[model samples]
Target: MNENKIPEKYTYIILTFTLISIISCIILNAFLFYGFMASIIFSIYLCRKSGFSIIELFNMIKRGLYECKSLFILMALIGAMIPIWMSSGVVPTMLYYGLKYMKGTNFLFSAFILTSVVSIFMGTAFGTISSVGIALLALSKIFGIPNYILLGAIVSGAFIADKSSPISNLFNLTLETVKIAYKEAITSMLKTLLPTCFISASVYYFIGKKYSVVIENSNINNFMYAINSNFTVSPLILLLPLSIIIMLFLGIKMLKSVFLALIAGIVVSIVFQREGFNHIINAILNGYNINTNFVQLNTVLVSGGMISMISVLLIIAGAVSLSSIFQETGLIIPVIKRITSKIKSSEELILKTGLISGALTIISDQSVGIILPGKFLINKYKELKVKNCILARTMADTGTIIAPLIPWNVNSLFIFITTGISTISYAPYAVLCYVSPIITFIFAFLHKFQGRKQTKEIQVKNTIK
Candidate 1:
């Protein structure tokens, strides 16, 4: 008999209790505290039933805590760096130039592409959505674009970059958890992401047909003037962040790269902003505020700080703790086993796993969706003789891309709260999010574009020689 096994009724009880806890946490806005407590209790219960001593449970907690230390430290550093960079005029400079380039174009597609690029650079969907996304929303009102379409385009663009960004925490988390090379994971993602982005861009282009306007060369000049007048702009400032991007592409660890880039930004700020050391200290502590004559530029530039990310950090910690408990309690194992057992074919397995992972985003959050499922599904794919690349690709497509589709999910909620755009309004325009999983499933089932055969052929030739 399995010591951890509970009666079927008790399993239902646990599930029910967990659901109630989660819902209450959400309703009461106490998700962080309640989630942490619930996780601890569940972990204790599981360990006790499994015949583990309190010391063993404490050790497990300690080990789990240690495992997340690096991630926490990285988060804190990023939290600090965001405001410093903002105050230094780096983000505002990008937005200023970005808006200048967008003048008198198909604004929808332009917004989509611009946000996509920036989000990719930022490696954060929420950051992209909050910064440039808010600007685009304001632009939508000015240009008379339908609100739903604008919302869709914004979400589509942000997710396109978010899904494919090498610097994204989810991207790195998935690669590390699956033990796949980061380059291979990115390559696999590109295979799925590029096509989905093409479709989404096409959709936005056609939708914006009526709104297309020819940009006069002078209009571009005026846009540039507007940006320059509004914020203290510098091109060299981008070099610091660009170096990090180059380093990431060259396979440096993300945390180290970010840390170095952040230091470079601080140095630039000290020199360029010409603010006193105490002023820099105050900005880092309380957040940065940029007051510009241009309200739009002011809005775009006003973002990021150590204080801003505390809420997100708390939410992440709570969600991760609950996820750890769910894992240790064997709840997820039964679910994974049941799903994997039903998968009779490789195609079915891939599709099933993708859908399950997508569904899990509603409850488990994106990190858990990829990390937990990626770990379990990778071995299953290997045993099935399915290519690990395909599994990794599917995980990226479904797990990372689908988060914004679930209204209550963290990413979606963040956008909804920040942009005041409902998930329902944005659902149709977010073609990449909806289409990626479908495209991935189609390829998996139809066996299209599979390079694994070539890999296998080479392996066989080597063996025969």
Candidate 2:
């Protein structure tokens, strides 16, 4: 006879133990690295108790890493690409033109849209925050807009492309985890993204009416001048981001696209900006560095390198190991099945997925937040006839977007460090973060009605026959 399976209650204990371990690190302000390690240890204990041998557990981890091997390589390429783009003047050039064309009338509205554009190009929240976000906050002081409200809009826009951008690590991770195609993921997410952006833009416009300040171009001009002085500003640099996007849409692999872009950046840095070959090599290894008289501009221009990706890689490895253990031991299946048994409709499923994602994001940072929920809930989504694109979109809608809203989360902490404002202070006004989930759920409800309508049409045709 087969051996008896573990009780359902054991699943609960495992999940609770894992969450507590991770949450403790956040509470104590310890590195999340320690938290992941603790979770890994506890998960190993659970796996062993369930009769998994050490070698079997190792194989599980190896299998998970194999699945994620592409993501690791892409992340490292992004790491190298960022510094090259910075040193090659691609980032600075974009910043120059973005600030030059930024609307000064509806300052709040302008801040949201402009930051969204920059974030789309930069493909990371922290980088966008440190660069355009810093400059926008400085302008907010001049326009007399509240720092909190402006920061809220900035943060909102900074994350718009987290799920949609081709170069975004978060986007790729969600895509890779769900095994969805790039085209499908983008198409699915846009359904929610377009509406949220419109609503957010309108809200900011109306709010701008509450505060009146004349548009002063001098402050903006100074920023442009500072950027222009540091590096060459040209339309040719636009080719770097454009090339990656073009190749991605044409079905080129993400790794090849990013790698090609890195090569292009190197050439641009050498031929256009005239950066020394040694300086370029150093940037790829360590990170780009620069010194300038403009203190504000100096901070934004420097960052990125392969070395900067080590911590992220380590965290991903640990999380993947933990996820593998859960999969191998079969502990999480019973838990997911039990919870999903109560889910009656597609809308309910989407709602619960969002809630789970939000909870995970609260307990862990963005990476683990997306990783765990995607792993656990994907099967239920398939059972419900839901497309994996929706699963990817939901995780991005809830976990990835809501991350910076939490005060102690890593993304929030980085925002605090960069902007010197508390997360709670600005979170209320981060319209996109709040709007995305609402819009997504609204779409879910609409999807349900559409499904019902289709079923009725099929029934009518059958009766006529």
Candidate 3:
């Protein structure tokens, strides 16, 4: 207690306690939010033991929640937008066109590509998987493709912009933590991501071919008809989703775009879908539900509303509180400091940074993961003459996408709860998520891991050649 430094003994006790708590939660099939809440209580007790007063604990938790306020706002807005869009026919209409165009063997491949685009505009992997990703899986189910492959494709694509989109909070958090320019950070990540995207596309293409099935025109008609009877489908409602993309590209912030889209969806739902004010109000509060002759279509078509985000909000709150306590107690610092001391070569540095950063990532939010690593390692990177951009990119390569692989992590938990795909089954096919670290590691070995714009570009070009 006198050290105020979180001595080695306390460190082991905290680590052991956290590990056991998480493992016990997993074995019990507990909701991850509960685990986070438990972790927070444990941290509070630890903080009190380590010379913190009740007032100080309250302030620390408040400060942590304040940092996460923007994310909390964006998530609530997203929750509001989902049901509005669904009732407006925005979602079903998109699915109709997607199915119409991306027919047969191309559907699975298209699902992968489309989810990437949707994830960027949606600005969260959870939103992409819950809305459009659900539709894609329904389409694949109708076509008789194995759920595992299509589910894998959906999860993989949903993560495409978890760390690169102009409007993504995770992307912003990474840049802020690494102290890099948005343009530069995006450019660096794209360099590593683009190759993986191309490779994953090819992989999905081949795999899709093996299981592709053709639906008769009648089946397509029935699909559209089911949606039509439930919600009025229109091309005009399409503008809402498209505006989100345009607004993001124009440098408008994500929440503003979400507001714009939400209003648009409301207007369309009222006018075209013949929705009453009460119906729209219900949609905003409770979400949209549509019933159809087919149970599968029923599952896919029903979604959205502000209320659905309650559990997610709770998880975020708990995660942030847990992260705040870690920051306050100096618990994470000693572990990171120890890792920093072991760095020898640039490759090991990059590899270990990725591994350590990734391991920490699943246990916390993206902000906490990158902030801790960047705090502990940026100076070392400077000593090694590596660019800070490489540090940012390496963090994403290891830490960013792997969140969805950890079944207990919030990202994976939301994906599993929404999509019903077990993490273990879909992880192997989340090609880009796993491929990214491998790509970064290869870049490290080739000595192409600098953030220097020109030199790193030249090295990467040569390595690619």
Give all candidates' CA lDDT scores: 0.68, 0.77, 0.76
In candidate 2, list every pair of residues with a backbone clash: none
Best by lDDT: 2
Candidate 2 — which residues are off by over 4 angstroms? 1-6, 103-194, 206-218, 344-350, 356-430, 442-465
RMSD of 2: 5.6
Candidate 2 structure quality by residue, lDDT tens digits, 110-220: 889988987776676765675467657755654568889999999999987676777788899999999999999989998999999999999999998665444443366
TM-score of 2: 0.72
**Decreasing lDDT order of the candidates:** 2, 3, 1
Over 4 Å off in model 3, which ranges? 1-4, 118-127, 146-148, 182-187, 214-218, 292-296, 416-425, 448-465
Worst 10 residues of 2 by lDDT: 1-10
TM-score of each: 0.75, 0.72, 0.87
Rank ordering of all candidates by TM-score, starting from the highest: 3, 1, 2
lDDT per residue (tens digit) for residues 1-465 in model 3? 122456666766776777777778778978667877777787778767777777877787899999778767877776777777677887788778766776654677878988888887767776677557766766776676767778888888888777777677787777887788988887777888888889888999988776555544327767777776777666776777778777777878767877887888788888888889998888788877776686656776666566777876787687778777776666777777677796877887888889878878866656667878887788999988778888999987789888888776667756654555777778888888888888888888777434445677899999999
Candidate 1 residue lDDT tens string, 1-465:
132454444444555666677667656756344655674586568546756576755655566556667656666666666666676666656655555666567888888888788778767676566546755664564455776788788888887655667677777777777787878777777777778889889988888877655333224454457567654687786676567657766767667877887777777777876656777777776676666564544544444456655665665565555555555545555566667876656878788778767756766677667766777777778887787777778878887788888654667656654555667778877877888888898788566345457668899999999
